[model samples]
Target chain A: MDERERINRLRWRCTRRAMLEMDLLLGEFLERIFPTLGPAQADAFIILADMEDLELWPLINGSRECTDSVQAEVVALLRDVRVK
Target chain B: MSNSSIPVRKFDAVIVGAGGSGLRAAIQLSEGGLKTAVLSKVFPTRSHTVAAQGGVSASLGNSEEDHWHWHMYDTVKGSDWLGDQDAIEYMCRMAPEVVVELEHFGMPFDRTDEGKIYQRPFGGHMSNFGEKPVRRACAAADRTGHAMLHALYQRNVRANTQFFVEWMALDLIRDESGQVLGVIALEMETGEVVAFHAKATIFATGGAGRIYYSSTNAFINTGDGLGMAARAGIALEDMEFWQFHPTGVAGAGVLITEGVRGEGGILRNSDNERFMERYAPNAKDLASRDVVSRAMVTEINEGRGCGPNKDFVLLDITHLDPATIMKRLPGIREISIQFAGIDPIQAPIPVVPTCHYQMGGIPTNYKGQVVAADGVPVKGFYAAGEVACASVHGANRLGTNSLLDLLVFGKSSGDSVIEDLATGKVAHQDLPENFAERTLARLHRLNTQTGGSDVNETRLELQRTMQKHCGVFRFKDMLAEGVAKIVEIEKAVARTEIKDKSQVWNTARVEALELDNLIEVAKATLVSAEARKESRGAHVRDDAPDTAENPNGRDDANWHKHTLWQREGSSLSYKPVTMTPLTVETIALKTRSY
Candidate 1:
């Protein structure tokens, strides 16, 4: 699939969290943060997508920070987008 | 063609709920060459099973020297000696195999440094029969159930098992000879009513935890299978015993898994004292759910509760390493911050006892065949998971055993169905002419009924009444009053009207239908709880005095047998517990204390 199709699929997955709180947070992140990412960052976004909402939610909440630089940057982006 | 003349769809086997158990069974049946159909009220992934945060129990001996026999002993004791030994032995023995099967199916189980499955200690899991806490819970970082359900769903998809998402089963269709024909269900998207005619029917529709106002169950866990079985003249076994998890987030009632305690989390009161150490000195924070819940409630009652209202206690994990918290209990951290707005790594999460699991359900044998009060199997009918009382978890289920029960019994039932089908003995029983009429009429009544009482109001009233009377603690006067009040609420439920006229994707209509089941479960729980004179396991009664032998005030002499609730005139009966296992010495009953 092309980049647009991949992003759309990722958006669909974001809305399907097991917990409703994660659903809202991830949905917001996709809508606001997806358009600003380059190809490598999009790949990093997919890596973050692979993690369960349980892991991803905390990274964005700043309660637990991600060690990986790519994941750390995505988490920062998500937090930034949430504040905006 | 008119909608009334909808043709029936045929399958070799039909499974309800599509959660872990239903999907597991569907995988087996489809792989066995049976045309299987799984009908679920929500998308398969969105089932209530996804909310389970702890690991599945297995004596894999990965983290410690553990054995199934020792696990069996803890389970029997945890159940307060009410669980059938034969089924307990079977489940404990199959735990390792099934957990391994899940691993082989690409379930993301956490691993130790040796590359074997990582095991965590859970409440009531011991090594050498009450020696010490044993590492038996095979985890996937507090998302074991999520991984297990996804793995099973994937396997079912591979096996080509047909799925009917967003379809709610209205009633069980039975022939005149009392054999299960299939079920009549409502397709939520189009509001079309359809019939599934199968040679065999399985009810894996989970528990009725939603009956209680403060529960960890999802909105969909209305005990639909139990309601259908009871309405179809099947006796619900042991409906009174409800497990109350001690660590639900205070106000929200969302679950904080027992894995938290397993990973060294402690329960503290308002005075900053570790209170479980007072109740259970040996097990401390890792006592069985019932023991811990009672301790928490007692602390709150004694004016030691935390928070402004003093209604809840604190679960402290701030002492644990931040890396460990993030790696092992990430979900709990997320849940705490999201639900309670408190992060466990920084501050303690406020929690209280919440209704978690139902030990009683549609009465079934160890083989998963639904049995009547006479101990005879209902032909072509089966049950598994939380909906079925295979009598494995007896009065209080040990943590992680719920997921294990789903896998072991789910697969057993599927195998039994395949064997029965291979014999060509249980052919498709013909449905009566008006089989679908009753179910259709129920839908019609809900679809067209004007205002009498709001659906949400009636449901909330039932929840409040249940929470008030039938809670962690019970007394004679309170239980009797609860029974009477529930009966009055039944009328309120009957008079409840569904104002949503649209048939397509009408959520109001769905809630209305679900309330029908919830009321049945609530009534059964209250009535059965009131009738049981003694406190056993989760059914702790304040009025019942402690016996010399039984420290918990459990009167096993009169109430040792399971209580069976039959819907015909709403009566009760008793069935003997199968104490003898297939090939092991009976674990003799003893006064249970942590």
Candidate 2:
């Protein structure tokens, strides 16, 4: 698979609890993951496993990064974890 | 301070100074049905014991045929015949069991393919009359002490032992007749003094390496227990002999564990010559710490040192295979990368000697019981680890013997204290008013003084003076001068004022108190160093070059005693060394080589 497709596949498997463990904001994990993988990939993988939602396709095909409303909800979730 | 008004916190045993020994002792005591409380100035995980990166010595008979007798002989010889042979034998015999116990506690020691713990060769560890090097040091991938400490802490947590973190013990609480009780501790967060009463107390507070400005010691290691014991009229044994590890990262003085040399790292100067071959032709790069440290300084003094400043030489490990370096020395790699911004795989590490471990502390017997100045056991008070001199390490500790000493004595002290507590005849005493008043006055003085100097600046001056004068090599004139300078610094310390007087999380008060401890220990160290004239172990005398030049003729007859330093008001006094209960034949002085 291409780098973006591989990242999307990894993000679909991500969980909120995993995101907290990696100490990353939720949308940031998706943004960094969707691009070519680097140091942030390991962090995103850990965080994705922690969230309650475990489905793959919605995250894979979702255009949330392009939409303002969906992006705000994802950012809000991360902000909550950051405060914790 | 009142008998009725004084608050009491009870434990079956209370362990002061939660280093390797304290943590290990707490685990044993709690498991044996004693309610134990471990008290430390830092988090238990950050104890100076964690700074030890080499390994613990034990004769596991790995890589070669080895026995406890061989280990004992090497220890006695490494100690330069100053060690009490009886205590040395006890430790050697117990070393195997201690390592096994640590393994049982889940310390991740490096293992051989046969699934047994791996042993490494350390400096001065030899076999068959120093004929061949032996594998005696049981290690865990260059972070043995770190792994051992983590294991002990985990075990302590499993046992549910109570811990009072960030509480500094000011003084030993004793009665009018001087029977030991507990301690007066200041809560770091609230600055409140609380009394922790126990049937028995153990001081595992590590060493006073910070007395020297540049040392391999952690910042928090300020000789707290040693100072407290000395101030309370207990004599510090062999305070003169401070071990300077040879291969510290030069300018920073961070320790590059002896394991580096064990793994074939070489020491070289600007000449690119292996200089140790001239000093110790046989052991070469792996000579005893005192010999190697002195040699390094001498090379620098002779203008053979590396770099522009010429203060340090190179510890080249780049020749070692990358896989071995990564697997066996992951922690060393991390420290070098984080602190010095260098990778050992590509370049040589800058290295020099730093004041490492104290060979002296509150004088104790082999049982780890704190003996008074009169040679009587102080009831309800025990000591272990680097703070207590069971005389196992003697004038100089061996490379891996320190961790062995901590674990063996720590467990023994726990068993002894628990046995003492089982009698249930311990008397509770009221905390004296003067004790609290003295501590309060010191804190008040720090808060109220208008300031003759900044505490940090004075501390830096003290460290620099110690590093220059009383370090690796010493002379009577230099030590005498160092003593005078330290005394002046002590006066300056008294006049020093706290800049941050706010009560909430006030570290300034802690630093001020720690300075008092440091100064007291520093005085004891200088005084003891001045008294010892002969070249023995870590305490080297330049003017009195050898025992042949000394007034005392015989080595075994004269120099076998411990140097005891007493704090008499503002003055210092000394007593003869104790060399008793000798079982094995004393090893006579020979030319010590690599």
Candidate 3:
């Protein structure tokens, strides 16, 4: 799929959550930052999307550090993009 | 023309609070061809049920030989024998079926190698008459409740259940003849008040864990249903008994599920001592939650605690393989890292007992019929889940049973309502005159009332007082003082004013209203706790010393019955626990031990 189609596909995945907090954080990342991602960042975003909300929430909250550098950088970008 | 003239809508059944129980009941009701409406303070998925991390208890015998008889014995013993044996028997017997139904409903529970639903050991669960830890808890990678909530919500959606999201029920509409008509609810989006007229009204509004400052409960858990029931002259049973989970993240009361211990984690003191071994030789860390919580408190009190200032213990799971931690306890690892800044794969997490669940609520029967103080079923009213006592958990809830309670009672309650409707038993009572008057007057008072007390400040004080005086260990004087202080707080709450007068999505107004509910719960807990003299289950009294025969100095001879605390004059009554099971022999009361 093309980049736009890929981002749209990932956006749909973000809506499936047991928590709205995760939805907002993941939704904002997809809408604002997904289209701008390169191939490596797109893979990282996919990993982030697949994680459970409890794990993803901390990454978005900047409380815990992710072990993977790629996931870490993408999560940091999402954190920066979030309106404080 | 006035607030009393709010529009009224009708449904066959109206369920308040769209968490697991409410959604499960909605699914059943809707599938049964009943027009059901589920009102939730937040979106259905956002209810506090999603925060539950451990598994649901059931004698599935998936991993080993287990029976509902054994489950009943453990639950009754876990409640310190204060639980009604009949209700306990019903819940235990219904466990396996309810769990299987949830699995069939597409709940993504972890599977054994044979593809059966996975099970794990939890505190107070045993096999062969408490001989060993049994894998009784049906799990989905420590996110059982989340999976269950999602599955039930999906099922409800497929069943075409109508959801009134972000709508808070203000009061129960009772007729002069003492039958519940339905409820007056506020729509948060438009700030419009509406009345739900139904043949039956079910309250599944979860627990009041937020009565304490440090609790695993979400902010939305303000005991709205309990408050409404109490105001409508229903009794809150055994309000003294609140479960304190042993492994809450230190300083942050978010839960670290006992599933950690069930997965081979250990609790250690500063000397690296497994203290639970000293307390409960067999179950150790897997003892009843009340026992484990009391042990932790005792360890901290004796200055054998692990963390700095010796105020907390350590939940050590570093011995577990990293992969197992990753797969089974991913949520615990994340919470430990974020809240306590410790990863289970590397180091121990600082932990302390935190307010987790309420073992008390509006008294109900096994069939989800809300009963009056005299043990008569309130016509047209029902309750299930954590909000209703049913005198099942009694004084202390066993871990994992809370979710199981929700499933069994929620489904049974829905079926009961269906039966009532089909049999033409539920009378279509007309809306009584001035039904909306009290509800509208209260809303108007909050909206137009000027400043006297701030909502947030009074709420904080209420939480602080409950946390300080009515905590894991209570004393006679402290509890007495707590009762008086709660009475004062109630007065202050009544005078509280809403600062923000915005009609649409005004959270300040909601908080002010929720504070009223929280205060009601706080008073019920403190006052009821003060009245119960003996230490029993989660209602441990510091002044009561343990004897050679009685564990926790539980005075079963005098205090075995359920405390029914009503709002009228804050009067306290007692109801005898039905000791006889339906078919099996009664599990005779013994000095409860792990």
Give per-residue lDDT, candidate 1, residue B494: 75
Candidate 1 residues lying further than 4 Å off, grouped into runs, are A1-84, B1-4, B256-292, B295-351
Candidate 2's displacement at residue B11, Å, is 2.7
Q: What is candidate 2's CA lDDT for residue B407?
A: 93
Report the lDDT of model 3 for residue B339: 62
RMSD of 1: 6.0
Give candidate 3's TM-score. 0.83
| Cα lDDT listed for each candidate | 0.84, 0.74, 0.84
Error of model 2, residue B88, in angstroms? 1.3
lDDT (C-alpha) at residue B354 in model 3: 91
Clashing residue pairs in candidate 1 (N, C-alpha, C atoms within 3 angstroms) = none
lDDT of 2 by residue, B454-547 (tens): 8888888888878767888886788899888988998887888887676545666777788888988888888778766677778887765645
TM-score (C-alpha, index-matched) for candidate 1: 0.83
Please count the clashing residue pairs in each candidate, in the order shown: 0, 13, 0
Between prediction 2 and prediction 3, which has the larger DockQ? 3
List iRMS for all predictions. 6.8, 17.8, 9.0
lDDT minimum window of 10 residues, candidate 1 chain A: A15-24
